[model samples]
Target: MRILRCLKRTPGIGIFSHNKSLIQLKAYIDSDWATCPKTRKSITGFSVYLGESLISWKSKKQQTISRSSSEVEYRALPATTCEIQWITYLLHYLHIQHQQPALLYCDNQVAIQIAHNQVFHE
Candidate 1:
């Protein structure tokens, strides 16, 4: 199985304070299959942030093989979108005003098209 190196951060490591409130966030999701001796299925992983602060992270094996890189990325979208929606709602519920239509950055054009086109899934 071919593995793709999806580095979450730049090479330099740094320390951060934990007591501060998180303001901004970023996320990265990727997959790897090279080390697994059994099923040989790739694993998907993600890292999340709060402002400049690291908040949450995850890594897991995919339930099945993705047909392409775009497919793998597509599979990751709903999960990320749900997280964004939850965060947005939380901010709103707390009376924190945020700019509308929160920005989501994705590299897959097909995934972006699918997100904008309601009929694609049908």
Candidate 2:
């Protein structure tokens, strides 16, 4: 596509570190609850950062409509987690070892709590 060609011509965003010290990978995930007025679907977004450098990010509308804000945020997490996992694997294959236990940040406190709980709720 035209946009892809334009992107290929442009320089990519990157950071150069002189020391090349070990840095932890962190991801922040969020969702816009019912952002689509017509479809009533949530928009999920997440950005992964290695220290201060931006690594990966994506924003897309969900296929299924979420009933609550908590549900919307929760739905966004799995994709973000998968992305981080893939990145981690790639780093390992490249002989790069990062800090253990990558941190994931989410805005919704209720969703975070619910994710940790084992009790099922309807």
Candidate 3:
């Protein structure tokens, strides 16, 4: 309602890139474990940037209660990864060439280790 009206009237809000030839994808993800006292479910949030402009973002509560902070952070990774993958695929479909790998940033060290550990995959 009011938010839509504001957006319609807003200026300089759309994605603008000075250099379209060099587009990069980057993501940041985080989660807060058991932030809701009633449900005890964690909240996962992520933002995706295309070069200097933000293209996608999400913030939602986890479907299940996470036992640990690491678990909650781990849960957030898949969602962000999926989003980055989707964007990559979309770029490919649009015939846009972004050769470099997408970078994902997360604050949880334990979760990062778990993601990197080969043993966890088996």
Best by TM-score: 3
Q: Please provide, for model 2 over 1-122, each residue's C-alpha lDDT reduced to its tens digit, 9 standing for 90 to 100.
A: 23235546774833454465447789999899999989999999999876666778899999999899999998888899998898888778869777667889999998999889889855
**Candidate 3 at 52: error in angstroms?**
0.8
lDDT by residue (1-122, candidate 3, tens digit) is 23235557885573477775359899999899999999999999999887877778899999998889999998899999998998898779869788789999999999999999878542
Residue pairs that clash (backbone atoms under 3 angstroms), model 3: none
lDDT against the true structure, per candidate, is 0.60, 0.83, 0.86
- Which portions of model 3 miss their true places by more than 4 Å? 1-14
All candidates: TM-score: 0.57, 0.82, 0.84
Residues 1-122, model 1: lDDT tens digits: 00012223533443353655445556766655433568655666666554665545667777876666667666777777677667666657768564435445667687677778777562
Model 3 lDDT, full chain set: 0.86
Rank all candidate structures by their lDDT, best first, as comma-separated numbers: 3, 2, 1
Which residue pairs does candidate 1 place in steric collision?
A: 24-51
